[model samples]
Target chain A: MRRVIKNLISALVALMFVNAAHAAGELHIFNWGDYTNPDLIAKFEQMYDVKVTITDYDSNETALSKVRPGGHGFDIAVPTSSHIPIWIEEGLLMQTNPNEMPNFVHVAEQWRNPDWEPGRNYSVPWTWGSTGISVNTAMYGGEINTSELFFSPPDELHGRINIVPEMNDVMNMAIMYEGGQPCTTDKEVLMRVRDTVMAAKENWKSIDYGTKEKLVSGDVAVSMNWNGYSKRAREENPDIAFGYPKQGYPLWMDNVAVLADAKNVENAKLFQNFLMDPENAAMISAFAQYANGIAGSEAYMPADLASAPEIAIPAELQSAGVFVPPCPPEAQQLYTAIWTEVQK
Target chain B: MAETENTSSVLAAQSHQVAIEASRRNKIRNFRLLSMPALIVLTIGAAGPLLIMLVYSFLKAAPYGGVVWEPSIDGWFGVFLKKDIFDGTISIATAHLSILWRSVNLSIQSTLLALILGFPTAYFIATRSVQTRNLWLFLITIPFWTNLLIRTFAIMQVIRDQGIINNFLIGWGLIESPIEMLYTDFAIMLGMTYVYLPLMVLPLYASIEKLDFRLVEAAYDLYATRLRVLWRIIIPLVRPGIVAGSILVFVPSLGAYVTPRVLGGGKHLMLGNLIELQFGQGRNWPLGAALSIFLLCVVMGALLIYVRVAQRGTTEHV
Candidate 1:
């Protein structure tokens, strides 16, 4: 009886060792919440015979704070274009080897050499969307297309508008509304933008991040939201509509990059290549309700999404879309200060 | 013979003293041994992070994020001043100071409101029969079982424009349009009061339950009015609970982040929200750490004053 018990204990210990070795082959992914398709993750795991672990963040700042500290154990992260430069400057990101990622050819030409990372050395374009107005036309009784309504709404719409909580996006929209450059660091121009925003603050219902749900529920008549979120909102409520401000709006792009201290660097690269495949990229765009940057991915996307102008910005209106650039440290500080004041 | 007796008595007294001292030392050693685990956990968990935050508050902010190891007082200056990078000039700013004042004002308002609502409820529960008191106490804690975020969101659903309250009012011809109730300061206070009311109630309940009912009856029998009896008898006995409950509610309310962010519409920026922004989008960790330390000092100062007052009160009573 004692020999039997000893053999059982040894077998259990040996099994645990094998499991530990298998767990060592896992991949860790950090991205926006509900941003990727689980089916794609499952397929990738099956294809590579590796286990995948996923974590989600709500904002780019949260992701940056996690990855900025070396050895956060995240093998891959998805950060916005503006944050990519900071990641590179801080040595938090690893340079991509295009030779190993042959599927890079399928990326759109515009994203091939983004101005932020000129040669696409450290980041791969994942998704792109515009920041614009999502209006409940049934509540507003008409299409609310211009930035003027947001900054200075009519009596009926007063105290019925919600703005994004993000400072850069809202400030950029205010600048565009005033016909100034979005990235202008001139104090005089920024002060004018600040005054405009302060004036608009009176009419705002709330400055919150959950604009999509607010619009759908009619808690807010108008909201500044990302294109994809607005698209999803419209699906839930037909009265909800997305409009690109005639005055121009900010364009946001998120990119996937391998962390510098990634334990599973090879697996991270492999997952990136797998995501670049046209069908898989289409699946992501369909699930996320956002446009993927892969060149041929639209061919595999659902017809409704492929035809939806909000999901894919119309070629003509694309000219009005401006890619937000990283601000200088001083300007960033000033923006934060102004945001604090506006909140007050 | 007298000298020898005196010497032996002195010697015996000295040995007895030594034996007592040894036992006292042994008692202290055992006490420390019993508390060692808690002390170590507190040091590692609380004191260690607080020390790190103190160090970071004195350092410079790295451009991308986090802190630089170099010593600098710029973060401290930035808290109360704005620097123009163009000409290297600094100007005094009252914006951050006003936010701090606002947070304290809101915290005090909420704490007082919680006390007003909680005392009566706690007193009523304490006066009930044991079985009923248990049921009422259980009901009071039911809200706590749900996550705070979900509860705040639920509050939004009730107070929003198309929410139940507005709809009911409109349907009953009480109003023509929805009353703006969700994003105002009123809503924030309501949320804070709702969240922290239980904190106030529990302490008050514990104090009220232990009160000598005979004293109240005797005061009433002496021709004291009901209100006078409460004022003279109940209030004096429950002073400690009031102090405890106020501190419990006030401290957390001062550092409230989500309630204000969700219900206040992020319009009224609290100290907690400002500190959070400094770390998140502002990418100014040094400033965030400095603000945090400032808040900590205020709380610690309040706690110390309370402790001293409490000790003095006890000594006077003795």
Candidate 2:
């Protein structure tokens, strides 16, 4: 009986060690809904011989809140640039060691050290896009520069425009159109954006997020939208025209960041490296129609897209684009207050 | 004779005792079984989140992401301060209150419309044979099986400029450009009426089914006119059904999000939409919680008003 008991105890200890070894291969990714190509996860799973679980959030704010609550059972997350600084400040993000990502060298030099994450220590640039007005050129006489199509369209088409419900996009567009700096922590700029938005509230047909399909279906004439959506819109109907105001276009980047308390750090790092591969980055960019940070992704892009004026970032237009940083609590509150009032 | 009387009495008493004990045991067993799942569902689904929201609403908004645990009434107070009507503060613009008011208005309007449209049809079905009634009820329910989101989108397609109605009109040369029918108040009304119509019909049908048609016949025999019969006798008979159906349609309509969001084209930001925003983009859980609490109050207030009116009417009849 003593011999049998001793054997059983030793066997149980051995089994527990085996279970710990088996747990390292699993990874959980939480990202924006419909943001990733379906084949990417399958490919990652095949490459690493690990299981991947994916979840989705509609906004950066939603993701942040979920992560702040000890995380929503996710190992990897893709947050927009605006929330990266805040996530870092809150100690929610883990600074990934560059040595772990062998493919990190393939990212574009310009996108490598964005202002949002100074050292590119915390985030991997997944896709970059400019927020602009995507319109049906045939319906609207000509290409328009000002964001006024959203706020102050033709009286006949007053309620026929769709604007993004996102705070920063709407607020920044308002300020930028008024010839003010985009995303100022200054109180005067915020108040001006608020007043401008409030004045045009009645003209807005809809304030939508994640409703790009509605735009493509001709539900709204002109929609304040992202570049990827505009690309798809034009692909579906060739007449769709995307315009970035000469004033400036609010540029955004979605970056993959491993969580601070991620259970599968090794697997997360592996997945991040997998995403950084030029071929894989090209696949995601083509499928998602968003610009990738990969140095060679442009060569793999479709011919029309490769030569597309909007996709081709010119030096002159580069200065017109601005990156929004994670805002302070007071600034967020002020924006929310203005938005709620405008809607009312 | 004495033996026969004793035996009969004993058997009757024993049978009664056995039945009572069997029922008692069955009741306890069923209660124990049912209470476990009921408690679990309530704890997980409703009570737990409600308790959390109650806690979070009093706490400060997280500087970066969530709410701080330290309790403060700032969120609730934020719901009350009157600011420039355009400010997002719950207190200043009072959007939550406005949403609540609009929800009540739309709910009442749609409920009344459903009652009007559903009552006659339900009464017709109820007066028919059971086979016919079931067939009609089944027909009424066929639409509900489809996804509500699909139905809403379909409604949009039917009313949009490139939709069938507009295409037919333009083809016939009835008008010029396709009239904007998609994102108007009319579209919202039509969507609400469609979504809640079946709800109105089912309850009204059940109520009218149990109503005695003889009562109306008897009134007619006593020389009461058809209008008088319907107004005084028929309606009174199905009062409970009306109450039940009204509650069913009104409650859901008041909290409706998708239909208004889609059909109304975000123009009609209802209570549900506002609550969704607060919990979502607005990232103001305290305000969201307060709004939720305010909606709950409105619902309770409505129920109270309905019960009072119903009670008063009942007393008058008595």
Candidate 3:
């Protein structure tokens, strides 16, 4: 009986080793749901002679939770730019050698050394866009160029508008609409924003994600949405239009990083290099309906996308565009409190 | 010969007693063995996370996301008090309290609405023949086949400004303009009623089907009007079903997230959404856990009172 038990244990250990060996040739990725272009993933798989397994998360919080304790064996993950610092502080990401990634030079200058990852050792920019308003031109019969149209609409537009459910975007828009700084930590200013949001709540159709479908279907005449989603919606319904709020919009970036416990770090680096190639980046941009951060990718972009106002940030809005930074703990709590009040 | 016979009989009786004791012990052991798997699963799956949440509720929320090991009651205090971000001073706030109150109020409203809408359908189904009753019940359950999100989305399609309802109303010249129907309190209540109506109907059907029709007939014959017969006889007979259905609908609606979130459009905050927000975007797990515990206690207390009242009712009836 003892001999049989010892043999069983040995056999199980051998099977585990075999399983590990089989997985070595595969790269696992966790990314934002519907954020990646599957064709690019297939192309990468073909070029690398390795299988690529991808998982998607809808929210940065969900992705962070999954990756916090060593990334659940994912080789690479796409987290919002704001979360890179937290990921590093939690030891969830692996440091990358710049020398291994020659394509790093293709990234735009501003995106190279993001404030979150100071030396740019961990993450590379994936896609970037701004949070702004998407309007059905036929319904609104004009351009929506300001947050005022959403927060304090005319009587006709009341109950015909929705805002994104993300706290940062909503609160920032409120702050900008009130002519205050987007990242203001002052209580008085925040309280004012809170009041504005609460007052506007009565006029809102809903505070929800995925406003693209609602806009296309004309369920809502106006919505606060990402530029990419607005662009995607426009393809289905040509009446849909996206505008940069004159009051400024929250600019956001999604970054790709290797996990600390990545089993296929080499493959992950290779994939990142492949994604950074201008043509590949343009392909991703075209597919995702979001602009990539690759500097020379515009030459490869399709004609319609290259000149599309929604995909390209106008020069005037550039100075007004602010990156959403992670707030301090107390400020975060305050934001949540105000958000809860608005929802209530 | 008599003494020998007595000794053999006594020995046989003692042997029989030993046999019974051994079998009883074996049966108990078998029962325990059979229950082991379930006990293990319950401990690991259900009780484990609950214990972790309880522990985390007392800990301080880490600045970034998760909780720190430091013990604190700040989460519990913060539920009803607003903490000043700058000075760290706290004051009584009605925001959270109002949210809780709103949740309770909406849940009660939805529960009553569901009950009103479900009773007639359940009764109609119960009065049907056995073959047809099953067909009706199956029809009632057809909604369950679709995902709740999809069903809610479909409901949105029918109720939106450019939706079928508005189009039909406009085409018929009944209304010149589209009435704002989606994302209102009415829409939330309607959605809740639509989702939980089946929960109410199933139990009511079960109870009404088992009811003795003779008592109802007797009450009717004794000069009891139809309304009086329903109020006194049918209602009393189905009291258990009413209580069961109310509990089933009310408790879930109290903590409902999706219906209110999707239909109410995040304007109508409920306890479940608050809890979810804490763990999701709010990044305040301690507060979320504390709120969860508070909600659980309230539910358990209400259930306890309900059980006691039910027991009293049963005893009085007996």
Compose the digit string of candidate 2's lDDT tens values, residues A1-344: 99999999999999998666644489999999878887888798778878788898878877887888694679988989887888888889888864347888898899877898876887787898888888877778654665777666777666667887777788877777777776565666666676677767777767765446756677667888888888887878787777777677799899999999999988888888888888788777877788888898777767676556556666666777789776666666767667766665
Q: What is each predicted model's overall lDDT from 0 to 1? A: 0.86, 0.80, 0.84
Q: Which structure is stronger by lDDT: 1 or 2?
A: 1
Rounded to one decimal, what is candidate 3's iRMSD?
1.8
Q: Evaluated on chain B only, what are the TM-scores of all the candidate structures, in order?
A: 0.90, 0.85, 0.87
Query: DockQ-based ranking, best first?
Result: 1, 3, 2
Backbone clashes in model 1, listed as residue pairs:
none
**TM-score to native of every candidate shown:** 0.92, 0.88, 0.90
- Which candidate has the top score in lDDT? 1
Model 3 Cα lDDT, one tens digit per residue, A1-344: 99999999999999998666555478999998887788888788777777788888888888887777553879998887777778888888888754358998898887777776776788877888888989999988765778888778888898888887898778877888888876577877886787778888888888887688888878889999888899989999999988898887888888888888899999988888887889889888888888888899999888888678787777877777778787677667878888887777
Please report, as a residue range, the 10-residue window in candidate 2 chain A with the lowest summed lDDT. A208-217
Off by over 4 Å in 2: A1-24, A154-157, A185-188, A209-215, B1-40, B83-93
> What is the per-residue lDDT of model 3 for residues B1-318, given as tens digits with 9 covering 90 to 100?
999899999989989989999999999999999999999999999889889888889999988778999999878887778776546677775778888887777778888998999899999999999999999999999999999888887887788788889999999999999987877778877787788889999999999999999999898789999999888788778888988998998888878888888877777677888998898889998999989888888787877897688668766655
For candidate 3 chain A, which ten residues in a row score worst on lDDT?
A17-26
Off by over 4 Å in 1: A1-24, A141-143, B1-14, B83-92, B304-318
Across the candidates, what are chain A's individual TM-scores? 0.91, 0.87, 0.90
| Candidate 3 ranges beyond 4 A from true positions | A1-24, A141-143, B1-32, B84-89, B310-318
Worst lDDT run of 10 residues, candidate 3 chain B, spans B84-93
